[model samples]
Target: MTSWRLSRNSVSELRPVLSYPFEAAPEHGELCEVAPGVYWLRMPLPLALDHINLYLLEDEDGWWIIDSGIALGPTEEIWEQIFANQLGDKPVKAVVATHWHPDHTGMAGWLCDRWQVPFYCTQGEYLTGLVYTRATSEHFGWTNEQHQIRAGRGQVGADAARKSMGGAGHITRSLPTSYRRLEEGTRLTINGQRWRVVVGSGHSPEHACLYGESLNVLISGDQVIPRITSNISVSGIEPEGNPLREWLQSHERFLQVLPDDVLVLPAHNLPFYGLHHRLRYLIEHHEDHLLALEEACSDIAQTAVELLPVLFKRELSDSQIGLALGECIAHLNYLYHRGQLERSVDDEGRYRYLAVDDTLPMRLRKRQHQADTELPVQV
Candidate 1:
């Protein structure tokens, strides 16, 4: 690997007087190989977003990679060290990205170009990722998904919202002009084993996952993680996100295919057992989200502003708060779909929610009804 700046002294080993919040670059020295023919790599990103995991797979052709690091200097430098030390003299035959997120697909284009290989992914993720520069998405709010959020001191007017997306475009590099679309169920070989493709949704469009039964391994992209719950955020582009529903179904799909002990290699966090338990946790988390928002909006007339806090579970700045809007819309939309929440646009053009009669999903409907009963007499 060429010498790059991402690799430097182990600054983490040095003691710190005090740790700053949201340090831009993550510590990159914490890489570990979880299994033979599979290596887990970490690279520094520019926020407290935590370290991103890039996977390397050994195949008969050479080294097959499931995602690339970001396109920043620190990340690039780390790749240089990686290629030199671990992949030295090895060829990268194919590059397959799990989704459109930059942290996972950032270095894909560069690696494909450098190694003269073809990049493959779902067409939607590819096209979206192609135009997905921080510059692009920032042009508008994260998407129409955000515009649907109502607020109490939360809604930034149209002008401020647009300003927030500024330079926020392109979360990841778009697919290069030269690439192949990976079709679901297509068989591929890696590390001398035949693997089948599985597609997951409600996270990114058409995210791809790989399962090798012989090795009892699943290369789960962002679909599942060990620690942090993956955000199934509603983007402006997909407003009618039944993500809560979609994600739960995805969990069932993920659980149905693999055996109990198939090792999981995720895009983030450490490898571990208990795939079913993790899926249950993710399902339960969203279930809580659905219930929490349902009850919060029941007590009073609520807008995106009112429910952002309950949904986000963290503080948001003037800009980042926009996601709260989409979150509100998602829950409201979910309830609306289930016939649990009534909705109508008021004079100012904001949608209001009221609980409705329902028997299905009784847990959510029951709380929503109580909140609805106590709601205001006036809109």
Candidate 2:
């Protein structure tokens, strides 16, 4: 029997409640009750950038914040509003991050230092978050991103990429503070409520998923969402990925253990019920992406960059295109690693891909049974 790898859930059982769309002038972030003691603190990431969700857990001693938002002007202003207005005297015991993403772990160090509280996360998450983010500072701050935009055709994306990078400097202004590592199945108590950790993969390495059994709440932390599928993008580093496979496996992990009625407190979308259904929908989304990829490449195998618009469509705006391209690379890398596609370099030093048999794509090969029913389209 084959051992199943970890993945992201792809079901659509729970849809976004449309709390606040991150528009040009987005709706400001606020604290909302997801479960009994679990609260989501929305943080602004301005103008087509990050819209992060920081969590707070009310406990007997004080509060335990999970995932501090980016440490920029807007994010800090909102954080001050939240910390001063709501959690004034409450002692922030610990801050837990789900992963190393800037949006999730951005202000962890600042918060921990401010409150004299210990930061908590997986060892992989804490260390990687610190090192990788710092190392990529130049890349994000528009220093070298021009190279990211397909070499010669890189003008249109340069500005946007620079803005994105500078935003990183704004968000990730704090690090070097200490953090405590939390492992999978780790249990803790908050204000009398008991919670366990459930880690997910593909989207980010060693991503943590918190489960509050008594309240039936899961602090999903980007592990799952309602409307839009969480991005499983492959970046400059770690070019090899089996994201489709990893995402599929992550969903099964959630389904096999998590109950249907558990309320999901996603890091992005509005919290809701139906974890099982959401898992299935997320799974189906990747499957569909793979199928779409298969169809797009049936005629001729294309490099991940060339095939992105075909998979996601060219209807998206400039920023959306970059994101779509990233996800495209992730899926394509996944397929490549699974041995379905062989990669080569042209004389011009450009990367190209070709399927094994040149007849049918791997996704289409065993897809007759499940592929019969149309899967939901990814936005």
Candidate 3:
């Protein structure tokens, strides 16, 4: 998913101030009550984002956990403390993964086995995670190298980039042998309150968000975050998927269905109130990026690598490059499918995008044609 970047200026212009009801996030291994019977748990992540927020709901007999932290020693230690100090004698009745990401589901298997609890998630996410964990180097590692090469990175660069891309699979532990599938609109009662499931895609396959009307809260997982735009990328596994379109459409549906005043408990950021404004901001942000990308492609065909600067204003680390590239391709593919741009693969196997509009000034058209011709043929 997308990384969090603080943009006070842009956010202020886009929407009104979002209320952060909590004065401070919970300390490690501790839980902060956000609503009645709902506790916020913050876990540390090794990544630049630094922390992931998980939720714990008090059930009649035990508790329900939403989004397991990554499978790491520190995370486990924190859980142990939570088990001993925070949860009292209550057991974890169920573990719900909002998506298949390691940060969200990495500890599912361990936690499930520890508590012997059922795993609840969508079928698509379960299967995807299963495949990802079982994937060999041939499937993930080699594929990444090839993808990098296709993006105009040479064989040497591809190999180096592959090393920086990290491990083959995201899951640190095996998933449960079986899972209870959570379909859209499914309803479950927890702690004497009814919560409905709302599913979305693009950031992850079948990402589940929980909306509790009685509690006036939404457990918005990665589907909606207060500070960061969730990463929506077309991965090598589904290169042709139009996730950007799915992401935008999901927000549209959320706007119609969700109430504006409900508190949003995101996977990463602090709990906030302003569901409608956040959805609109996410939609408009992507639309603006698409328009700018389309305009950039007007004069010449560009590969995803070539257009990175058009999308990101700052430099990216080696670890961030792969995700950036994937997101760039996703935006390009969205425009390509919508007839706003023409996509083509060069002899070297790299994909390039060109604007579709032909009504531009003759001088600009001639310059475009000349630029295209003068560009070196990769093959």
Candidate 4:
């Protein structure tokens, strides 16, 4: 579930509106101290986005590693280097995976086995990872091919997506069979400081973000990023899921609970300080997209593939098409679930969406307006 657009142009306009607090990023395989006893590490990804950021927190006896990198030769090599050079004499006491995505938790089992420590993450994420890893097997019937076909992707597109998913190595060979579940409000004492877990969904099942009130740091695992919006897609498992709505609500919750000045350490981008600004930006960004999509479907019903050009103006590569399609369906499902649009299955087993009317109902319009003008919650 590497949810990212291959083309940066899709988010170019939003990028200039936000600012990065840190100019320097950690070199690959190296750690940069973002806060006292907390270090940031960047691992190389083989995709267009190119990198994922992992964090290490100094604990009482050892270190707590957050968001392990993908289980690839290069990524494992980087971890080896960090163990030899960066960790000094301290051993990794625990491996904390923010979610089930390979880029985030691919090395959880490997790290836990190496350190003989327990794996920490939400129960949903850990269980989903098991499902995804098993899905790579030949005997697994629910492949990405079927998922694409169910999402209105043509046969060619479905085949291409299947090939890409198989090649991505998303499901690590070694997945942890056991884990320690971290739920909302669960706090862990690391190095005399408390880090509380805050769970959010839409991007992944039970995505856990750690908030340290004393340090005013939020380890936002793919939940909130400064530049790019996290991928909120309608997967085959939950085809009718309105993840877009869940994603926005999660931001609202963040605004309610988090202080504005907390430095956010995201999974993909550089560390930044504008938590509320970024959250509001993401909310408005999707709202604008939903408006455009609603208008596009006013006359003719459209498939998720047909609406790609409406949402993403730029051309997409074969690999990006699947992700873009999933994202497009997410927005369509949001509108469909909200009564803004109507959905119907065609003769070919494809779902088409059409706007219900030219104008939204009073309640939906008011909701949209509130989202447009809503101010960030003051801490």
| TM-scores for every candidate against the unseen true structure | 0.80, 0.80, 0.88, 0.88
**Which has the higher TM-score value, candidate number 1 or candidate number 3?**
3
Q: Candidate 3's error at 114, in angstroms?
A: 0.5
Query: After superposing candidate 1, which stretches have Cα over 4 Å from the reference?
Result: 1-31, 134-157, 166-174, 358-379
**lDDT over C-alpha atoms for residue 68 of model 3:** 91
Worst 10 residues of 1 by lDDT: 1-10
Model 4 per-residue lDDT tens digits across residues 262-350: 98999997898888888877886787678667766766888888888887878898667767888998898888888988888787767
Model 1 vs. true fold: TM:
0.80
Runs of candidate 4 exceeding 4 Å displacement? 1-19, 137-147, 162-171, 358-379
Residue-level lDDT tens digits of model 3 in 55-143 = 99999899999999988659998999999998888899999999988899888899999999999999989998888766754555666
RMSD of each: 12.1, 6.5, 8.4, 5.7
lDDT ranking from best candidate downward: 3, 4, 2, 1
Q: Write the per-residue lDDT of candidate 2 for residues 32-101, one digit (tens) a residue.
A: 6656777767786654645776788998779998888776657767777776778757778888888877
The regions of model 3 sitting more than 4 angstroms off are 1-16, 141-146, 160-171, 358-379
